[model samples]
Target: MPKSIVVPEGTSKPIAPFSPGTLADGVVYVSGTLPFDRNNDVVHVGDAAAQTRHVLETIKTVIETAGGSMEDVTMNHIFLTDWANYAAVNSVYAEYFPGDKPARYCILCGLVKPEALIEIATVAHIGRP
Candidate 1:
């Protein structure tokens, strides 16, 4: 199947060699996203809740740019630098997906950037069966 890159307006140029998202076979595969500013530096520093909000907003943009919405998301891969931030992350996360939460798994581990407390990659199906 053919795939197209999804780069929404104002998206920071990724520090790595990867598109922000890829659309293939009616599915939008969003790359792991961090809470970053236009300079590619981690934002919200030590605040996990703010960081989670930023990451989710980034993913929301990518998905919407690919003709989908948060409601279309099927799964999410969440990563965190510390387990203690789990509640903070989830509290902000619930605001994004208030109903019919997508399937997800959270891992307690290190991120590419030391100040980045959260990273989220998402999958959304936007095509009909």
Candidate 2:
């Protein structure tokens, strides 16, 4: 199958040049997402948990837009500006994938939006490639 980009109607616009998600060969790849609102303004600036939750929510929407689900997620890449917020971020993350957790790698790095506490990207497989 040919590759297709996924962009849910209400999600925040991309901060840079990248699709919100891409689907090819039955696999969906969500780009690192920030906690921004429909107006493209950052949300939950000071609260790590809230920011993480919103980030995952954005990822969920993108994957679903491509016809997949959180259960279909195979892996994720987490990017945060500070390591100190790791535990708080994980607390919210556990709520999203309560049963089958996807393989995840967390990285400490500054984000394009310095107010964002976390960003997440994912790879999901809905079926055979």
Candidate 3:
């Protein structure tokens, strides 16, 4: 059986009923991350591009905390409140994964939180040492 572990960072607390990140077998799965800042506040209020950046940055930090880097990411699932914001989200996303981008899926959906225009979840592999 694979053991499951949670990602740890003492700076901010999780406000929802979810683990920040989980380790199972040799892979790390990070939960859908919102555009919350270090203080756990939604930082990007008016811009979808800014919100996308925040979501990606948060996912990157969670992956790194699990001993993985953005380069190690296998897949990403992106959720946007509106499809019209695709270009804006894509532009910001390209900045983070500059080369060898991971496979990704983008979907337009109604968000649980109104101010959040974007959310990103990631899967990464921490290969055997």
TM-scores, all models, native as reference: 0.97, 0.93, 0.89
Q: Which ten residues in a row have the lowest lDDT in candidate 2?
A: 9-18
**Model 2 compared with the native: what TM-score?**
0.93
TM-score of 3: 0.89
Which prediction has more favorable lDDT, 1 or 2?
Answer: 1
93-118 per-residue lDDT for model 1 (tens digits): 99999999999999988889999999
- Model 1 poorest ten-residue lDDT run: 120-129
Our tally of clashes for model 3 stands at: 0
Please, what are the lDDT tens digits per residue for candidate 3 over residues 1-129?
565666666637778778888888778889988888767777768799989887887788777877778889989999988888899999998998899999999998877678888888999998742
What RMSD does each model have against the real structure? 1.3, 1.5, 1.7
Candidate numbers, best TM-score first, in rank order: 1, 2, 3
Error of 1 at 86 (Å): 0.4
Clashes within 3 Å, all models in order: 0, 0, 0
Instruction: Give Cα distance to truth, residue 126, candidate 3, Å.
Output: 1.8
User: Which candidate leads the pack in TM-score?
Assistant: 1
Q: What are the Cα lDDT values of the candidates? A: 0.94, 0.87, 0.83
lDDT of 3 at 51: 92
